[model samples]
Structures are given as structure tokens and as C-alpha cells.
Target: MDRLERVLKGKLEDSPGASCYWWMGNWRGRGDLADLVLKSRRVLEESGFREGMRLGILMPNCPMVLALSIACWSLGGAVAPMNARSGAEALLRTISILDLHGVAYVEDRPEIGEALSRAGMPSAPCGLEGPLRPFTGRGASELDDPDTAVVFSTSGTTGLPKAVPISHGNILNNVTSSIEHVEFLRPGEVMLNALPNFHTLGYSVSGILPLVGDIAQAILPSFVPADSALSAINAAKVTGIVAVPTMLSMLMGAVLRGGERPEGVSFIISGGDKLNVDMDRRCQELLGAPILEGYGLTECSPVVSINPSYDSRRLGTVGTMIRGYEHQIRDLEGNLLDDASEGVLWLKGPSITRGYFRDPVNTAARFKDGWFDTGDVVRIQDGYITVLDRATDIIIVGGFNVYPQEVEMALMEHPAVSQAVAVGESNSMTGQVVKAFVVLKEGQEASPRPDNRLRQGEAGAFQGAPKGGHPKGAAPVQHRQGEPQSA
Candidate 1:
């Protein structure tokens, strides 16, 4: 058996009756999960699946998603989890690029079926409950790397989604190092897995880490309808939560509106985006847990570093890099910089993938001699990493670097602002200028002098700009109170 299969099989034998996961309002035992894996494997085999094939999955977080992943590994195949909410054209493009042998998607979505048909791909309908149907596509195996366990989809710099194939060893190293670094993820404690499984952070940290670490997981289809997420937390008596900043903000909003704070939550792990300072403070006060913000990317099997504990954590920094990884700082011209200097991050380690799946051109552009360019500009001091902004997201105003996160942080200090996203807008004088989109908290109104309010926020945060005036050649900050921000 492969390494992943061996570990899971051992867990199944060691804890037959222990609660493995809570889904659909019930806690299922390890033995029950094992049975599902076996059944799933049988179904795959019947559909002509074999070693060295790739299986595509388009579904939310559920038992079948986990079961199919394990089943694929047991048969020496890699599983590709795609976003279920993607548009039909995007899904079709991804399917064509992946060259999947077969696909399993939610039964209710007809658009997915149409995409599969257009791609001439084999597919089957899947659900949270019920036996999986055999795939109808003619499965011709192509993948030959037995070490590959999962092929995660990430949006490339060119705007199309690229496939990242993560090896079993890559994931195992990440999980082991993460468990050792965190120190507080004790076995038997329940973790809430509400992030979509299609996301690399959701797949590795929230979905698979709990299983390998002997920690029970509470699964939700998605972190929507905050009531459902809160119910899962209380029902499972969850002790840990892995979420992005948006999810944390939503949960905090729910709690403020008379929802009970989840009991026994030890700590919240925030990744995938910068955790807002105001939201972090509100979470501690209302939800009664410290938010341990971390840094990661999909190419590195999802996790690179995280704040180890509440007491040892530095509020604005992503804690020390985990074991088995080496990092370097490089300037815009690709010259190596001193540790204390700020630049883009380059990573090399056992946990990092070799390259993007079957895309040598893009992979060559990003990876150099085994070192992957993370494209995130960061500063390292005393072994702690403080992410400033994406190298691409930085705006240049009068030859001054304007980091969007700093602007967003300043905007969030306003009482009425709930969330904010800052982007670079084109300017003729300066290369680019800052344009912010603000989301107001419920029942909160924007200030009448919005331009003055933005000027105050920017003036306090950025010293390069004059006190009472806007940044040089910069346009007035734009505000949209109730509009949704695109992901």
C-alpha cells in the first residue's frame, strides 16, 4: 500500500468505533468511513479506473469527497478537486486542461454535466448521501507518477486555472510539520472543515490533516448560512477552526447578532488571506478565541508557516517557518536580499511540489532550479514572516510603493467599515494609484464627507503623503457600501 493508504488503514484498525467525522447532523465512526472507502474503491474499479489515472471531483465538502480521495489513493490514482461554483466555461476549460479520466460531481448541477459532455469526458453524479454510481467515460490512464495524491486547481497569473499535482510525501511532510509546529492540535479534538475542499488550504489542512493527526473533523458543505456553521460547531463541540479572514468575519457578525459563542474552541487558524486587525480583535472578544494567522500557497501543499501558539504569536507576523523548508528573499530583479530586507519569497523544501501539472512554460516562469517564487512580497525578522502584499498588487504613486493591505487596514479602522479591498487604478502621472472598495457593517452609514474620511485614514497610515492632502497624483478613494466584492 502507498504511504497515505497505509496511514489511513492503520487509523481505521486502531480506532474502529472512534468518531472520525460529523456530517449531516450525525457523527460517523472510523469503521463507517472505512466501509465507505471500500465501497468507493469498488465503484471506481467497476468504472475501469486503474493505477496511474486521474479522477476529477466537483463537489462540496462531504463524506463522499473524503471517501473518494482515499479510494483514489488506495488504487494508485490522483484526485483532482475542482470548484463546484465555477462558471460553465471555466469548468469546461479546467476539464480540458486536466485531461481527466473520469469525473464525479454533484447530482443537482446540470451545468457540470453539460461541461463534461462538451469535453467528451466520463462522469458520474455524486451526493452527500447514497452510493456512488460507476463512471460512464472510457477511462484511459495517463498519469504515471504513483507518488501524486491530489491535483489541486489554482488560478494562474494569466487568469486561467492551472493544475498543481501534490505528491503523497509532500502532503505527509506538511501535515507532520504542521502538527509539530502548532502544538495545540491534540488528538480527539474536533476541527471544523467548512472551507471548500477545492481550495488547497481546505484540502490539506482542514480536510486531510485532521484525519492523519487522529483528530475528529466536523464537515460542512460550505461556510455559508452562518447559522449552519454555528450549529456544526456547537453540535460537534469543536475545539479548532481553520478559516480564511472572510469566514471569521462572517462568524463574528453572526455572534454579534445574538448567536451563541461556540463553546470549547481553543484557537482559530486563519489562512488564505490577510486577517484584518479589527476582525481579529472582534473575534477574540466575541468568539473567545485567538486567531493564529498563517501564510501559505497552493503550490507548497498549502501551508508554509503559522503562529505556533496564542502566547508566542506576533500579531502582525505569520510565525516562524515550519521544519523541512528553506526560504530566501529576492528583489524585483531576482537578486538575493538580506534576511531583514523585504522582497518576494522563494521557497524550496520537501513539501513543495515539483511544478504545475503538464504546464512547463508557466512552471518554468515561476520555478527556478527547484526554488518556487511565491510572488508574495514579505519581510522576515527574527524568524517571523510579515507579509506586506502581493508583488503584483502593489501600487506605485510618485515612485512610492503603496501596499493595498496597509490601505485596507487603515480603512477598516473606521467603525462603519466591515470589510475592504484595495486595488490599483490606472493613472497617467503615476504608474498606478489606490482605489478601495469598502463594505459597511450592518445598519452602519457612510460618513457624509467620505473623501475626507478616506484622506484621514490614509494620512494616519502613510507618512509619505502630506497630512491634509491625498497621495501625489492619486485619485480620491472610492467607497461602495452595499455592493459585493468579487473573489
Candidate 2:
């Protein structure tokens, strides 16, 4: 048996009656989970699932995701999880790229059914409570690597989605290293798995970590409706939360609107994007838990570094690298830099993937000499990593590099501003100038003219500020929930 199967079986044997997963106000025991995995495996086999094939799963975060993944792995197949919220066109593109043997989707989404039917791909309607119904498609074929456990779809540097196959060994290494590095993942603690399963961070950290680490978890289909999430957290007595910064923001907003804070939360693990300082401070003040921000990329089994604990964490850095990773800092021209310098990050380790599934061009471009180039520019000071910005997101203002996160942080210093995103606008003189889109706090009005206080604050906070004045463009816009406003 693979390590995942061995550990899961051991967990079940050790605690058959212990609650393993909590969903929709009900808890399922470890034995119950084991039975579901067995039933799912039988159903899949009866439906023509075979060893060495890839099965596509289109669903939110739920018990079925874990059940089906375990079942596939046991049968020597892999599971490829696609974003259910991604519309039919995007879903169709993913299906074509992965060339899956079969797919299982939630009962809803008739459009997806239609697309699958048009494409002649075998599919089934799946849910938390029913026997899976089979559909017809091509026969299973042997995979290049039968040890592949999960295949995730991620957009490459060209802005097109590609398939990344993560083996069982990769996941086991990450989970083991993370548990050893972070101290809070104890058996009795309940982790809130609110992030979507389609995201790598969600799958690896929130979804799989708790299971293999023998910790009980509360699973939410989605993180929206913060009031509902809060209820689940309280009901499960959750101790840890792994989510993106935006989810924390929404939960905080709900609290500000008179919702009760979740009880017993020890720490909030924030990743998927840069966690703003204001949001971190607000979490501490309102939720009574410290936000331990982390940094990762989809290609690196999703987690590279994280703030290990509340007592040992530095506010601005993502803490030290996890165990077993060898890293180097490289200049833009590919020359290696000193340990304390700032530049693009390159990583090599057991958890790092070999390459993309079949795109040799992209694989060749990114993976070189056993090191994967993570396109994020970061500064490492005494082992703590401070992610500066994405190399592609940097703007050049008359030969000076301007990091957008710095500008956004400066803009957010104003009390009236609730959120900010900075981008580059074309300018004849500087080649590119900073442009900012600001969202004001509720009941706050934008000033007709630029505020001197804000200007002075920016002058001090932003060292890379373009000469002469504030960012060339500042526009107030309405805040759209869950929609990223980036260039």
C-alpha cells in the first residue's frame, strides 16, 4: 500500500468511532469514512473505472471528494479536480486538456452535463448521499506514472490552464514536513476546511493535511455566507483555519456586522495571496487569533513556507522554509545571489513536481537542472521570507522598479480606504506610471481632491514612489465581493 492508504487505514483502525469529518452540522466517524471509501471504490469499478486512469471530479469541498480520491488511489488511478464554478467553456477546455477517462460532477449544472455529452466524455452525477450512476466514455489506458495521486489544473505563465500531476509521494512529503514544522495540528483539534478543493493550497493543506495527520475537520462546500461558516466553526469547535486572505476579510466583515466570533480558534493560516497588514491587525483585534501568513505556488505542492506559530511569527515575513527544501535566490539574468538578497525564488525538494503533465515547452521553461523557478520575487532576511511581488506584476517607472503591493499597502494606510489594487498605466515620459483603484469603507465618501495626509504617508511608507507626486492615477470604485480587480 502507498503511504496515504497505509496512514488512512491506520487512522481508521486507531479511532473507528472518532469523528473524522464534520459537514452541514453533522459529524461522520472514521469508520463511516472508511465504509464510504469502500462503497465509492466498488461503485467506480462497476462504472468502468480502471487502474492507471485519471478520473475528473467536479464538486465543491465535501466528504465525497476525499472518499473518491482515496478510492481512485487504491485502484491505482488518479483524481483530477476541476473548479466547479469555472463556467462550461473553461470546464470543457480542462476536460480536453486532461483527456480524462471519466468524470463525476455534482447533481446541479446542466450546462456541464450538456458540454460533457457533446464532447462524448463519460460522466456521472454525484452527491454526498447517493450511489454514483455511470456514463459512457473511452476505456482506461495506463498512465505515464501510475503513482500519480491527484492532477490539478493551473494556468501557466501564458495565461492558459495546464494539467499538473502530483504523485502520492509528493503529497505525503508535504503533509509530513508541514505537520513537523507547525505545532498546532493535534489529533483532538478540528480544522475548518473552508477553502475550495480545486485550489492546491485547499487540497493539500485544508483538505488532505487534517486527514492524514489524524486531525478531525469541518468541511464547508464553500466559504461564502460568512455567517454560515461561523456557525460551522463554532459547532465543530474548530481550532485552525486555512484560507485565503479574502475569506478572512469576509468573516471579519460578518463579525463587524454583529455576528459572533468563532470560539476556540487558535490560529488563522493565510495563503493564496499577500495578506495585507491592515487585515492581519483586524483579525487579531476582532477574532482574537493571530494570522500566520504563508507563501506558496501551485507547482510546489502548494506550500513552501508558512509562519510556524503565533509566538514565534514575524508579522511581515512568511517564516522559514519548511523541512527538506533546498532553495536559491537568482537575479533576473539567472545569476545566483547571496542568501540575504532579494530576487526570484528557485526551489528543489521531494515535494516539488517533476514537470507539467505533457507540455514540454512550459516544463522545459520552468524546470531546469532539478530546480523549479517560482516566478515570485522575495527578500529573505535571516531565514524569514518576505514575498515582494510577482516578477510579472512589477512596473517600471523610468528605470525604477515599483512593486504594486507596496503601493497598495501605502494607499490602504488612509482610514477612508478599505481596499486598494495598484497597476501600471502607459506614460510617454516614464514608460509606465502607477495607477491605483481604491475602495472606500462603507459610509465613507471619497475626497474630491487628494488628501495631503495620505500623500505624506505615501511619501514615507513607499520607498519606490515615482518622482514628483502620488501615483499618477487614483480612482474610487465600488467593491465587488470575491471579484479580483487586477491588471
Candidate 3:
């Protein structure tokens, strides 16, 4: 068992009175779900998977997913997580790298299946029957697995997606400190897992740390129908809801539409994209709290810096570094700039990813001695860091992270999408919502009716075209006034 799993098991064992909870879609209100975890542990052992090099999970935040994650890591295996929302080609690209003998798909999403099939990975339906026996031997897996179960890459949308290896030691440093800072496990704390399990935010909060820390995560396939979000806040009595500006806007809309936000919600930590100031103020007025933003990349275990839950709720800034990190702003000369000076963000700490798998050239380029250059430019003022536009076109929605490349890839996968480029556009609610600029195949023309058109074979999609040969899923196109951006 890893440090956190051991700590949680010990903690839960020590305090039998302590309770945990989760959401079961139609089943409303938080209730005890710890028994399911215990059963999963026993069932996983019975399912013939006690020890392994590593086990990969690409699932939504289902109850079984939560249970199976705890069960697998408890025995051994690093619990490598991949995003279920990734494009088929992107998913296949990863499978080709991991020499894994097996894979588990939690939901029946055709996208996951299509991607796996395209990748030639014959994944079986994920079963909750991973077998386990009491192993007397101490920590069979190294605290950090150089070759054990681990995350394969950072968010793949930017550059060539590089595999980032994380060890048990790394996991402990990040989450243990996180719970301490956020007080997530303490009584009266509730979180909404609107973020997917594949990304770092999802992996840490939804997949791993919840039960281990004795907190509740309201899991949904995806956050939508803005009004329902507000109802969730009031009904769930959510304390610390981690979302991006988009989700906050949705919730705010819900509140204005008679959606009640109970006083129980104490903190709202917004990150995974640039924080919008206007949206923050609206939320503060409606939801009765300020929006706190943070900044981090997947390579940093996704928590490089976050706003302090109680004291510092800077509206435009992504707060300061977390308890132990050194967040820096550097000029082009590679010299660290003093506070308030805008420059590229550089971070270094125990949380830094080991390196990219099989790509040493880029790895050396990205790392400077110990600090990793965060391509995003940021300015720090009064200990609050304000993140500007990305060094690239990655945009985050409602705290569930998104990248233009990923969205573009999806649009291109549609049969009619001849070319697509997703960009961040202004919205009072979501800070930034993904806007796609599409070019059609030879016969297609841009249409006003987006929903009325055929989703599969209308404007952007073309089949079996080699990469770059067609304009599909191209990189970001900067826009000037009165011009529509294109791939």
C-alpha cells in the first residue's frame, strides 16, 4: 500500500465512528459509502490482480471506479490514470507506449472503445474483482516506482504529450499537504468532482484522495444544465467546490434563476484555466463567496499554487504557492523577476514530475537544473499570482480542464468536420468557453444552425485522413478584431 492508502486505512481503522459519502446520481443526499470500498478491496483480491507492474484506469467517477481505485493501489500497482475524454487517436498513442498486458474501461463510452480499438488494445470490461491476499512483506513496490504503475504523460494537447512518471512518494507529498491546506477531510467539507478522473485534478481529488481523507466527492459524468449545479450546491451543502470560472458562472446563473446556495459553501477554489475577474465578482454576490483561483500543470501533480481557503481569495489571481512550493516568475534572460513582474512561470519542488518517458531531449529542454518552466506567463502581486493567457491555446471550463488540441481532435473525428480550431472566448459565467472555428470539406459551407445540422458528417469531419494533410484539429489561430479564427 502507498503512503496515503496506508494512512487512510489506519485513520479509518482507528476512528470507526468517522463516516464517508458519495453521490449515486438519482440517489440524492450524502450517505455512507465506506462499506463499498471495503467490499471492493475483498472483491478485487478475488478478481485475480493482487500484484502487477502497473494497472491503468480510464473511467468516469462511478462508485465502482472509486472503489476499484482504492482496492488496486492498496495491494500494489501505481494506478496509472488516463482521461476518458481523450480522442481515439490520442488514447491509442498512449496504449502503444505502455507495454501493459491489460486495461480496464469503467463505462461503456463508445469513444473509449473506439480509441482502444484504434490503438489495437483489447481492453476487457473493468470488473471489481481484483484479487488480493494479506501480504506480510513491507511495501513491495518502491515508494516511487521508476518502473511501477504511474501516469504516462502530462496533458497531451500541448506539444508532443510526454509521459510524466509519478511515484508513491510524490503522491504523498502532493495530496497529504493538500488535505492539510484545504481541510478537505475534516467534518463539514464537501466537493463536487466535476473534473474528470483522467486529469491531475481529477486523479488526485476524485480518484485517490477522497476516501483516504474522509471527504465527499459529488461525481457526475460531466457538469451541465447550469441550474442543476446550483441545486447541487444548496442541497449537497458543498463546502469547498473546486471548479473553473465556467462552472461557477453556471452555478451563479442557477442562483439568479432561484437556485439557492446555502451558507454551507465556505470556499470555491477555481483553477485549471485563467480566472476571470468579472465572473468572480458575480459569484461573490450571488453565491455569497469570492472565487479563489490556483495555477498548476499536470507535471506538478496539478497543485503548484492555490489560493488560501480562508484568508486570501484574490479574484484575478491564482493565489500563491501551496504550503511548500516555490512559485517564480522569470524574464526571458532566465533571471527570476520580483513580485508584480509578469514573465514565464517556473516551479520546482518534490511535486515536480520525474521526467517524460522515452523523450530525453524535450525533458532536458523543459527542466532547468531542478525548476520546470511553466510555459504560461504570470504576474504576482501581494502574494497573489495572476495568470495571463497560456503560452498556448489550452482553455479550461468549469474547473474540468480542456485543451484546444483535444477539442479540435474531437471535432475532426466527426465525419463532417473538415477543419477545426477551438479557442477560448469571453463568457460572463465560464470565464472562457471553448469556441470552435471550423472549415468544411470541399462542398460544405458555414451554417448558422449548429444543432440543426448533422453532427457526424456536416462541416468539419473527414475520415481516415493523415495528420496535417487536412486542416483538421490544427493548432491555435490568433484572431484580430472582426476576423473569425480558423485552423
Candidate 4:
């Protein structure tokens, strides 16, 4: 395997003039990035992170994390990026899953470094160590076959999370695929790095990929205050960035709260959550950028479908299939569904992982049928697919299929509702009843209205009220001979 060193060399030799990399606070140039990566690489190479060694990476979202990632990859070590806030249980679990040889953490933060040092003091584990210095040391050995660049625990959101084993090939392919799909990543466009680095989206879009691909990345410590992201764009004169729907919502709120948005931004790429059309429109009003949502998961090396940067976007849909991926929807019986019909969405592509890390059972089960089961119910209409619900969260309500997302989306439309999650309740009469938990908008009451009292499974469902209750004669839905009534 040629590995990341070859790729980095290719970028430096190939795109030397690409000044758009990491914009850390006041630093907004490529020379700094190249120097930083080189230094970090030396430290890593000296630390014995040779080929096939697994190294755990724990750090917050910053330029240092990006440099360290590139450094580890350069040394042919498997880089596992873990969340800094992760508890001891999650950390130990991650280490075990990756079969991590040892861990390397940033000593830049005093508090965190102290905690991690204390955490590691109890045991005298035999693992590599390096002194804290501005990246400098010997490079990797002269001759050795390259290995996988990084590994990360699977999102497990769909099931028991497995540690995902991604090769340098996987990362390169994903980055290439995204660059192909995005189209207008200009030579000098500034990007806001907001998503967590531990996630596939974070490390891909903001960390290593953009630098290698020659895009300017402005780092925000995190995306908590959309103001920080927006302010960076305004001050840095940034163009666009990739972010989640929640950040967009918060940005829109910030704009509504009497703050002007960064004027130069054309648009942003949204992922990792559902895109709200209402919020997107709000963004179009505030930021002047159409919020384009892409569908993806950790298994696909993350990206699957994305709305083209310049195309007219569809509401309630996460755009067209990404390049080099065959995406389809299929029913439970493993039969493929036609357009406009709903089914489990499945994908097969070059970006798809070879398998889970060290778990052949999951690999076989998830990859056996020639497609990865997304476990998401969706409908493809006119080349646009709308995600209906997660298969695990679908509710069977009174013998009728009631998708919780449908209810939640409907309820979200109400002016008083801020957020809603619908779950199933086991019932004596009905198999399950849809019960919604809502966080109302400020100043709104959860009090039920008179119209809300109308009974379900009765005449009030569609036609009219019962005969005696109506001012005039009305037809109640009548049950014919031996027919079962809903109520």
C-alpha cells in the first residue's frame, strides 16, 4: 500500500499553490499547515508508529487534531479518533475494539492532559511514548508495506456499534468521491470546520481530506455558538462549510435574534441529521445559501447522496445518489421497489467499507447480500428519496402502520411545537398507540384544544359527527355485515 505519505507528497508536489487549508484563529495560510503536518509526522515517526500499529487519538476539534491525524497516517499507523469527552467505559471499549497498541493524546490542553495522565498512571503499560515538542523526529523506516490509515468505532446507532476498519484506500476514495460530487469547491473558498473530528463527517470534510484536496478549512473549536462559525466566515471572508441541521437551526435563530449573518457565504452542505425545509427556507432568507442535505452513514465511509451545489433542490429529500454508488430501495422480502414506493434503502459503492474491524460475523451479515441494509424506510419519487423513518423506531398503531417520523414532522409544523419524538405505547385494545413527547416553544402551553378531543377510529376521522351530535343528518361510516369496526 502506498499510504498517506505518498498522498501528502502528491498533494504538495501537485498542488503547491493551494493556500486554503487550516485557518486557525489568525493563521490562514498553507505554509503553516504543511510545516505543522511535517513536524507532527516527525514526532509520530520517532514515536514508533510504524506500519500496522494501532494508535488511539483523543483530542478536541482543532488544527492540532488534524495535524496529528495526518502525522499518524503518514507513519502507517491505524488512527482511531475518539471523543475527548468520552467516559472511561467508552474509551476502554474503543481501545479493546480496535485492539489499540497504545494511545497518543494532545498535551496542549492543561486540564485534559492532567486528567489523561492521572488516568494512565495506575498501570505501567508497555507502549510507545514521545516528548511534547513542536513536531520533529525521524521518519518511518526506509522500506515497509503501507497499512490502513485509520479506524473508528461504528456509529452503532443502527445496532451494537462495531469498530469500523477503514483503509487509506477507503479514505482516499471517499474524499475523491465527495470532491467529485461537490463540484464548486473553489481554489480559495474558506470552509468552517464545525462537526466533531471523531465522526466520519468531521475528519473527512474538515480534517485531512480538505487539506489534501486543497480547500481552506477555518476551524471553530465546536459548533455550539453558530455565531462563532458565522463570525469566522465573516471575518475570514469564508465562502461555505458543511454542517448539520441543528447548527442551521441555531444560526437561523441567531439571525432572528437581531444579528446579521456573514454576507459572503453562498451555501452550506448539511448532513448527519434530517434537513428541515422550513429551516432551509429560513437559511435561504438569512444566509442566502440553499441548505443542501446529503444522505450518508458511517458504513459508506460516510457520503452516499448529495444535492449538487448548483442544482435546484427538492424539499423533504436528501438529493441524488453520489457518484460511484449504486443506491436502491428494497422491501422486506429482498425484492427491489420501484420509484415512488417506500422500502428499506440499500447502497453498494466503492466508498462502502470492506468490513467491520475484527468482526467477520457482522461483516458477513451486513455485506452478504451484495448490499448494505441501511435499515431506513424511504421512498424515491422522481429521483429524490425521502426518508420515512428508521426501521427500529416504526410503530404499529392499532393494526395500522404509523411511522413516528410522520407524526413528528406533522407536529413540528404546529407553531407551538419546538421539538417532538413519537414512540409506541403498548395498549390493551390496540396493539400499540402513538404517544408523542413534545418540547413546546417558549410561551406555548401543552394544553389540549377542544378539537383535539375528537375520537379516532370513528365518524370524526373523515366524514362527520355522529347523527345526534350533528345539526343536520350526517352519514357515519357504517360497518357492513360481519365487518370489524375500528372503535
Candidate 3 lDDT by residue in tens digits, 1-487: 3555566566556655543544543332212234545765664454444555345566655665555555566767555667654544555556555544345665444455455555555454543322222222122232344324356454453534567776666666777667676633465467777666667776675445665566766666556666666666556666767766656766777777787664677667777767657776776688776776777777777777777664646566776676667767888667878756889888888777767655677677678888888778877777777777566556655455556676666666555456666777665445456666666666655454442222321232112233232222222332223333653
Q: State the lDDT of candidate 2 residue by residue for 1-487, as single tens digits.
A: 2557667878876888989999888998998888878888888888777777889988788888898898888787889988754434446667778878888888765555656777788888887644556666465544557788889886555545677888888899888888888888777888999787877888889989998888899999887789888888898899998877657877888899988798788888887666666778888777768788887776778789988888889988888889989999998877899978889999999888899988998899888899998888999987899988666665655323445665566567677777777777776444466777777778876566556545533533112334445543323233333333865
Models, CA RMSD each: 11.1, 11.3, 6.8, 13.8
> Any idea what lDDT model 1 has?
0.79
Cα lDDT tens digits for candidate 4, 399-433: 23344554444445556556656566665333356
Clashing pairs in 4: 20-216, 39-135
Positional deviation of residue 316's Cα in model 3 after best superposition, in angstroms? 2.3
| Order of the predicted models by lDDT, top scorer first | 1, 2, 4, 3
The most accurate candidate by lDDT is 1
| TM-score of candidate 2 versus the correct structure, residues matched by position | 0.80
Between prediction 1 and prediction 4, the one with superior lDDT is: 1
Better of 1 and 2 by lDDT: 1
TM-score of each: 0.81, 0.80, 0.76, 0.72
Error of 4 at 118 (Å): 6.3
Model 4 superposed RMSD (Cα): 13.8
lDDT of 1 by residue, 1-487 (tens): 2378889989987889999999888999999889999998999988888887889898888888888999989998889998654444456667777778789988877666766776688888877753678765566535558788999875565556678999999999999899999977779689999888887888889989999999999999987878778877998899999987657767877887888788888889988765556667787787778889888877898789999998899998888899999998999778999978999999999999999988998899889998999889999988999998776654545323445655666677666778877777766434466777888889876665575656545432112234566744445656675773752
Superposed model 3: Cα runs more than 4 Å off: 25-52, 107-120, 126-160, 182-185, 333-340, 397-401, 407-429, 433-487
